[model samples]
Target: MLPRTSFPSAYRAAPTLCRRCLLRSMTARGQQSRFISTSWLEKQDEAKRKWEERAKLIEEGKIQHIWDTFKDRGYVKDLAGTEDQIKELMVQKRIGAYVGIDPTAPSLHVGHLLPLMPLFWMYINGYRAVTLVGGATARVGDPTDRLQSRVPMKKTDMTMNITKIHYQLKRIWLNVEAQATRFGYEKEPRIWNRAILNNSQWYASLSFIEVVSRLFKGMRLGPMLSRETVKRKMEKGDGMSLDEFVYPLMQAWDWWHMFRKMGVRMQIGGSDQYGNIISGIESIKYLRDTEPDPDQKLSDDLSNTPIGFTVPLLTDSSGAKFGKSSGNAVWLDQFMTSTFDLYGYFMRRPDADVENLLKLFTFLPLEEVSEIMEHHNQDPSKRHAQYALAYEVVGLIHGLEEAATVQDQHKGLFSKGGATEVSSYPTGGPPTANMASAFRVDIKLPESLVLGKSITRILYAAGLADSVTDANRLTQHQGAYVGGAPGQPAATNRGISTGELTFTPIKNWFPQDTRNFLVDGKLLILRRGKHFVRVVEVVSDAEWEASGMMYFGEPGTGRVRLLRDALMTGAKEGEGHDLSALSSPEARRDFLDRAEALYSDEAGRFKGLPSEAFMVKKTRARQILEQSFRVFARSGNQSAQAKTAAIDEVLERAARNLDGHVENYMAEKKRQEKKKIRTSRPADEKSAVRWV
Candidate 1:
């Protein structure tokens, strides 16, 4: 820490003053301690000229050249500062801005998007960005914008949350950069870097007294108490704890630290943080003035000063806050909310808020936004603006391919009188690719299979549509859909299901450039309804067993190893733990029962591990187990009846009725299926009936 400047020795004994007033006459020692200059700053006149040009751009609200928002809708207003100050720091000095979020959860929802939009603007317009996750401050908890106080989070939980958020922030920045590249902005000489900062580094080491001295020494009780956040808490008279009151001070300190350490001058936050932002600005100003540095005189220009900007509270046309608090906020994580759901959410935005949301959430040019709004006005029902907004936002969050899939699914499914039924005949892409909206499972075709065979055999071999009796059962109702030749319209083929056909159809959904995925120069993709998809490669059974493929955990867990050993020795479950005994339906059922219990237990306790590494373990287990059951169910094995029965029960248990036809929530998927079973099935058939 730099000490305050003292008066020159010559004036120390003189009748009137302390060294604070005579800074210019400070000793050589004081001068060296206070001043350090960098080439990042420019000459006084040059910087001032640049500032003037930017200020004009700001006043005009024209992002024509610099592509930043100052007085436009993007600007909610600076924290009691002039627009010129904002422009000067952002444009002329090329300073960085930041928006700090506490890692209260694993993912960021739409509520965090508001502040990030401007931070994105700053990034593209040649400003640096440092996104701080409040790893330390989260421990103390911020009292702003809350009716009740926050419960403290465990260290492990906070650590896990930080890891997940760090991943998300990095992911978002990459997409932003890619967007920038398309805009030809990165070609400029400036290098853009997005930094992820965890606040624990500084705060974790400081003692309470040290914190008070470094940050709160200059904070006044009157002003702190008078702030809206504090006043509200006081009004409730819950006898506010010192921890809650100091929450704002922690945020203020964060800004001050960023300014000093990372050269981050602008603090961007939501409207709720207006008071905390101001507090930071005050503390920074006071510290700069009091820190005894001779170099500070060389930088008397206002460009070095810290400033802040706030985003207005975002809401929908209904006046409800655009947040998860209302239980409708969209999440960035796919597990919490699917890509299709996100697309639908934005695509159905009310006309009143679509334009504003576009400007705020997307990087589209305002001129283009205006044009889209015009087109939308001409035909509101066409939803031109809403579709554009949805595509852009979804593309940013996921990718262009994912967004395109949603659009295709929506258009294909809704084009026919809002029909949820899929065409028995191929409608969109190639017949095999038509099921692309659902899923992709990899399997192996029998080496002896011949081309131009039958589609029903392929479905059975892929463990897609259960038993022939089940398929017949489904067909007798409305008819169950299955993938085959693009032009074939049969709901189910009688020949293949009953083992009458020996050859298989070559029709597949696999990509044309498939050098990497092919086995024995042959790979097939199959689909059943809108949700179920399977991939089969033509590899001999002998070749598959010799391929050294073990589907289990890294290095194979003990259970997986035991199972593999049993498969080699044909030992029974408890006696030798042999997988060869898996032929027995009883053995298969016993193994699945135990495996199910183990997977459920691990999934239930996954949070006990580092979330970044283990969060998806349970989901993966269920998926692999489901696919495994299908492989066995379709195979030729001893004790056929027992094997088939055991495989069916386990597959049903693993799937939990998520088979292709069982629609969860999305109606769009219902329309993507190449074949539709419009008729309802018996309750037992609709559900995965118990066998054991």
Candidate 2:
């Protein structure tokens, strides 16, 4: 009642009408605010429900959630979607996943294993696993985390790489399956819906116009420019090429194509690829949502959303990336990195990283991994965890049998005892105590060349010492041992006995029968210090003569020969030659000039030995010659001028011999090339035409 009097004019107006209008206005304002707030709350509720659903599914064992598995194993670094989204999609249905690899090199390396782990898991779980080889994109080269554009690969090299990579990919799958079976995760071979697809298959026919019209329209410049990689490049002021700038778009097209054609919903890559992966996800969404074809457009459902998973970039304990760019790639190819070396690489991993590496690399169970770490922590000196990790990984990449052989080789070569019984040999013979020669031979000399040779001469020929003088010095200090396994031999020159094996060490200088030194009448093991080992396999005269092995008197005579026959025969340069005729300086100079002309020829580039093999041989030859010069220059028997003169003469003779070998190599190459053209050409016109 007091308020009505105090309100005066307002209270005097129609109270009922005023009250009705006020209630109506308040309701209108309330509805607007409620709509805005409830929309946000609805989203929160939906998210919570999804999370609960995912958790329940994991609990009930409805699906092995990829997110949980990857995250737990340290495989995940970034994800394009929420964890709930990934879990829900995986739990709802079996989906397709892929990883793209550009065949920039001839082989995959250890760094490439990160993303492949998730793909492997998906494949075994009956998901479509597609390994997309970026044959076309390799030419463009991904600019992710790169400061400069990659050197463009030649078409011939690219083709060779693709072929080799295809073989490697298939081999990896087979090896992975075998390894998975060993880990008690067996799946039907027929259910493995894996494909090693070359992106060139699609890109070859896809014109630039098609790319702009179909892919570019869906991409936004804002996000592309905002990418961390692009931003970094711009800030660094390193000129970025258009090809590099549009690299993400090209990758986006790859994923979009996979999604539409193959139903692939997930893409796995390294963390550096997060920006590119986001681009891919966005592109998929844009295309699917705005597709012109009604049948092709995806339904507006959360399950249809594409996902991206990024694994942490593989790094060493020092935090350096393990990749070709870093120049520390451990190649997967046996020729590039031998099985023993590969095993050793893992075995040398630090104890701090062994547990994490085990989870990442091997398919071992978590409980077992914990047990291993527990045991390793107790006695880190033994490296039990590293041993298990190395064996498991080597077994996965190379077959289990090769793993076993490599293990045996490791123990025999580096174990406390020099000799270890091996079950197999590279020659595929019976078990042997000669494990050093079984797996690897440092040199192969003809029985005729080695049987009557002095120990110093043999050592020099084996490339163990720089010269005869160096060989004699090495023996004088007992730094050299012959006919013993490679390790600490017994204190006496008589022999070393370990278990049932007795190895005799010979350290004599004069020419004597080597029958007592040779093992099985074919193998001789030489040790320099505790680590450097040289295993010489003595072959039959016929085999050695067929090879490029040549003996040109003693090391003091400056008689140089090819250390590896692979340089000549493997280079398709025909058989060994008798270059004894080129002893005269004038004759050798004339031969060298002729050889130089062939070597400079463009065709000679393809016909000669592989560049790597030739470079290794040339480097070794240069090192030996330099060492010989140094030793002769320090000679106490001759004056400085006389020593210089003698060194010059030795170098000239060695050069002459090398020139003769080159001449023989190029001349043989020319002959082979001519023969090839002749054989490939059609017969003369008169021969092919009828003489009507």
Q: Which lDDT values do the candidates have, in the order given?
A: 0.60, 0.68
Model 1: lDDT of residue 319: 76
With candidate 2 superimposed using the best TM-score fit, by how many Å does residue 352's alpha carbon deviate from the native? Answer: 0.9
Query: What C-alpha lDDT, on a 0 to 100 scale, does residue 221 get in candidate 1?
Result: 92
Residue pairs of candidate 2 with colliding backbone atoms: none
lDDT of 2 by residue, 1-692 (tens): 12221223453344344455555755877788833577667765664565467558776989566667877899988889988888778766567899999888877899998899989987876578999888888888888887776888765456546645665676678777776777777674434578888777777567999778777876778877887888887778486788988988888888989888877899999878888888888888887888888877878587678998899888887899999889888987665776777899999999889999999998888899999999999999988999899888887776677677778777776543232222112224432222222222245877766777778777766665655677788777776766543353333233211111123444664454555555455556665543234557778879977886564333323322232121123322332343444445554444444333332232344455433322223333333433323433443333333444444564566556556656777788888887786667677854775532
Candidates in order, TM-scores: namely 0.56, 0.54
lDDT of 1 by residue, 392-473 (tens): 8877776566677778877776431232222232334443321332222444555444133344444444555454444444
Off by over 4 Å in 1: 1-70, 187-190, 292-300, 414-551, 554-692
Model 2 residue 32 CA deviation in Å: 59
Task: Give the range of the ten consecutive residues with the poorest summed lDDT in model 2.
Answer: 493-502
lDDT of 1: 0.60
- TM-score for predicted model 2 compared with the true structure: 0.54
